[model samples]
Target: MKQKSIYLIRHGETDYNRQGIVQGSGVDSDLNAMGQAQAQAFYQAYQHIPFAKVYTSKLRRTMQSVQFFIDAGIAHESYEGLNEISWGVREGKMPNSFDNEYYRTLIENWAAGHTDYPTDQGESPEQVANRQKPVIDLILSRPDENPILVCMHGRAIRILLSWLMNEKLATMDLYEHSNLCLYKLIYSYETKEFTIEVSNDSTHLLALVMHQ
Candidate 1:
């Protein structure tokens, strides 16, 4: 058993994000101009880390977020397990008052321990975690691929971290995230546990913030 370092990040913003539209697994969108700039910023900051492998959701946005790494010849892989949760009826819809209230109630339900409750035809937290199990297992088994970079979506990241940290799905909101935010974790094979070294870090985007 060997220790491993995981550099997990949410994909950069898309037009859906900028426009406040719901983009779940059902929608496959490309990164907007701002997203491309964000990807460049991330690449500039982490280009020297010597990542062993890069993993992304099957969605193009996730891959695009880490394109620089893939272009640099780093081995890359995509998995459905890393895809964003399907928003079902809400997918690609701009929020209206009704949708806003629906989400508020959904979050409240989730907070009330009904974590398995799904959106209208969408995935539940438990369902997402189940699909992610195999991916996490595979990553843990491959010790040679240390210091891997994983680009995934927002809610999926929260769910994955909850599972890795032994936290209940209802508490996943504690793991807040933003586009291109990094969450660095260390896995100890000996202890069979994950330590969150960095949580929701966006320091690399400071220059972008300053420029804006």
Candidate 2:
């Protein structure tokens, strides 16, 4: 059975990440200094792989994380389906008592097995999984994008992978994740199924630099 593969990376860290702010799909912040270093490390580590295509969410962070590839003349595309789950009214606020309680509650709820509970003005895990469906289908349809390089956000990527793994959405975050970490999922055309080739791997950036 022929299998299709994609190389996925969670976008590098942002200032929001460092300061504990909520930077979801609604927040279009770019990569911070640490984030840039992480991206460069990834590029240097895997520059040998000829990515068939690069796909990212419609956010600056995702795109910026892959700017090296784009500069290398690698073809790329964007899909809103890959964006992070919107954090609603908490978009720019820090996840602290001083700023907002909603963000913490949201995270706690998600981790406590309440995956479908939506943000007051944002989205739920179920909603994220639903929208990310098309992105998965599109990648499967285009095998030419084999070794498709995907750059996206944290929470949303978990939902995407959970959908691919046929796991319950409540257990989605069971898959470990980190900034600039890489994961791979392969789909077999013959069987019409998917398999995770790798998950939450960031050894390539190890000891490269320290980050918060």
Candidate 3:
């Protein structure tokens, strides 16, 4: 069975993240100063991996997070499918009491198996999964890209992990994430299964941990 390693990570923090405002796929924001430092730390830790290619969402934050590798001449690709889940009307807005309650209810609904439920005019987990299917299939089919680095958004990463492991979408929240955290996975072609080597690993950020 041919196997490949996939290094998956979420983009670093943005002003929206630090300010506790929602920034979904629609809000194209860049990484902040702290976010840039976190990205540099991650690149320093994994620079020896010799990644075959770098993949990121169309969002700038994801691309900026992995800019070092891309600038090093590593092949790169971007996909809209990898973008963050759209929070619809809630995007770019700080969560007020009502927004908080709505978010709580939305998450509870998702956990209760209402996977198709979406925020007001937003995309559902099922919708996001459907969009991601083609991108994932393309990644798996590329034999030349043996070991790839992918940077995406938090909600999208959670959805992708759940889909890859064949877990219920309702359990997506079980996959925790932070800025620039990594999830290393191995995919076996013969078994057509993915084995998670690491999950939500942030050891590379030990230096930044003390300050942030």
Q: What is the C-alpha lDDT of each candidate?
A: 0.95, 0.86, 0.94
Better of 1 and 2 by lDDT: 1
Off by over 4 Å in 2: 98-108, 111-114, 210-212
Model 3 has an lDDT value of 0.94
**TM-scores of the models, in the given order?**
0.98, 0.92, 0.98
lDDT of 3 by residue, 65-84 (tens): 99999988999999999999
lDDT of 1 by residue, 39-72 (tens): 9999999999999999999999999999999999
Residue 91 in candidate 2, Cα distance off native in Å: 1.1
Q: How many steric overlaps are in each model, in order?
A: 0, 0, 0
Q: How well does candidate 2 match the true structure in TM-score terms? A: 0.92
Q: Which stretches of candidate 3 lie over 4 Å from their true place?
A: none
Model 1: runs farther than 4 Å from truth? none
For residues 98-149, write the lDDT of model 2, one tens digit per residue.
4456556766788787888998788999999888888878878787776779
CA displacement after TM-score superposition, residue 12 of candidate 2 (Å)? 0.6
* 2 versus 3: better TM-score goes to: 3
Candidate 1 colliding pairs = none
